[model samples]
Target: MKLEFHCWKCAKGTPGRRVTAPFNDSSVYRFECAQGHVYEIVLAQLRFEVLAETGMQALVDGYYRDAVASFAAALERVYQLYCEIVALSRDIDETVFKSTWKLVASQSERQLGMFIGLYMLENGDVPPQLPKKFVEFRNKVIHQGLFPAENDAVDFGQAVVNLVQPLLNSMMPRYTQEIEAFMIRHFENAEGAGRSDRNKHRVFFDFILQFDTEADDWDPAPADLSAELVARRSREIAD
Candidate 1:
């Protein structure tokens, strides 16, 4: 099958050529661009990379990647990545932001699951839920050594049509919109928003002030906030 995808390096949308690589049923895709930036992807590695760079995941054949991380550890990693994505976007609908996000498109369950986790955490809306057969089919695509029946896989494709949106809504409340608005208001359109790299920290700082508990009910009247909290917030925004 053929699909259209963009290169991470050059931002050129190339028609992707997929070959069933070695490892037979493993289903690995080697995506290359004319400019020669190639991504050799399977299921798990793609998930880590997608979230690290784009706040999303790359799925292959209805498969997604996950690891059992302690809640605190996961929180630290995810939150840090979220802050970085926000800082890079600078309140703009930057190309990198759009190209990397996985809005649960077909054949990319990894992307969908990552979106689900975040959307759920943030109280976003989800579409319908896939039928149990489809869930099993998608799960088989992710975990090796789990061969689901071909009929189940086909059933999954059909049932997913209704459930995805509801599942998505169950997670985050207009998750994309709220974050996009944050980017536009402070980074893209804010006056005096300089383009210097150093000033980038200011954007994250502002983001933290907008969302973090440290800033909740902040008394701007008394010195605008305690000096210690200010220092802590500053350090967080920097790191």
Candidate 2:
């Protein structure tokens, strides 16, 4: 698969070329940009992290609707990721677990909450409630035609980012720590030059890496970005 990387030196997205490397008793793949900055590719959490950052950017750019949608998308990604984690932890078959998720997704009201409850039951981690709130807000905007305010969008986006950051850290410790260190170093350089845009990019780059980790064995359920949710919400609004 073609991967993208942010070159702190180039301050932009660069094409990453993949190469194999030996790790302990086995081999792993790594990516190198043209500038020779090599990084591990953690695809599992990368998708959700990218969605979360896109949502944050939309909020920063004053696109409230898109921000709400993106945050909702991020939250959904989190739910699916947690489900996959749960399944992996239990040694359950992917096909069975995915079929179960599909059935659960067909249900309305607190669907994500149910998955969160299952995860907490198994992992014993009391997840933050912000994701539940964000889901409600997303439903309101998409289904009730409610236009979320700027502050609400910003808060929700930040909350989702805060929640996912730690989860990614725990799931992929060494890789995340390395990425964090790299970003921190670059952040210092950007801060020294007083380039706010570069600093923002650094933050986004960190967010992107937050989702990339080594334990990416399972494929997450596909994200729901369709208009179907909005259409259903519209019908509810009319009634």
Candidate 3:
């Protein structure tokens, strides 16, 4: 089905049309602008495009793609949590929840990204190509609106979903174990998933380090952060 809408970035009239890409089978979408920049919107969510034309990809993403967003957000929170526990935990600061909660919420976004990325790797639809600088820009959004906007996120999200369909079916038994196997599949010349400790965390760490320089705060906690007191309190308030 052809989706009619304006280009999210250019505000020019464009439609979700398809053309063959060099590496993949499915026809990836070509979102064009009158000026020049074209967005290859792969996983075509008609609903999102409609809203995006109306200038609401951010809102739509928050609703539909909350998990991916929350993953990054959660890590940012854990960063603060770690810093706080390490330094400020001694002082009972009431304003501690500001950035911490936002970061915790980002955990879901990370999970969603992992889920989709792994899924794409399993299938042959798209390669496992994540843009590092793009994420770095999002981190900057904390200070200024200088980062690349939600369109890139939408494009990446779509590509991930598209690529995972095939792999999702074949790579069930060795899910995490197989991330390495397929890492080379997408990143042909690049390093595949390294089994060793320092190696495995590159992609994981790369995702987080884009915004903040700290490494993954993944500790063998007794419970998950989402399952801990913070989540419980949030739930209580919601209830």
Candidate 3: which stretches are off by over 4 Å? 1-68, 71-129, 142-150, 159-170, 173-239
Better of 2 and 3 by lDDT: 2
lDDT of each: 0.34, 0.54, 0.34
For model 3, how does the per-residue alpha-carbon lDDT over 55-114 read when each residue is reduced to its tens digit? 222324333243334333433333233333222323435356345444544564544444
Ranking by TM-score: 2, 1, 3
Worst 10 residues of 3 by lDDT: 204-213
| lDDT winner | 2
For every model in order, what is the number of clashing pairs?
31, 1, 26
lDDT at residue 32 of model 3 (Cα atoms) = 49
Model 1: lDDT to the true structure: 0.34
Error in Å for residue 124 of model 3: 18
| Model 3 residue 109 distance off true place after TM-score fit, in angstroms | 15
Candidate 1: misplaced stretches above 4 Å? 5-150, 167-176, 179-239
Which ten contiguous residues of candidate 2 have the minimum total lDDT? 20-29
Q: Over 4 Å off in model 2, which ranges?
A: 1-45, 107-110, 131-136, 172-209, 214-239
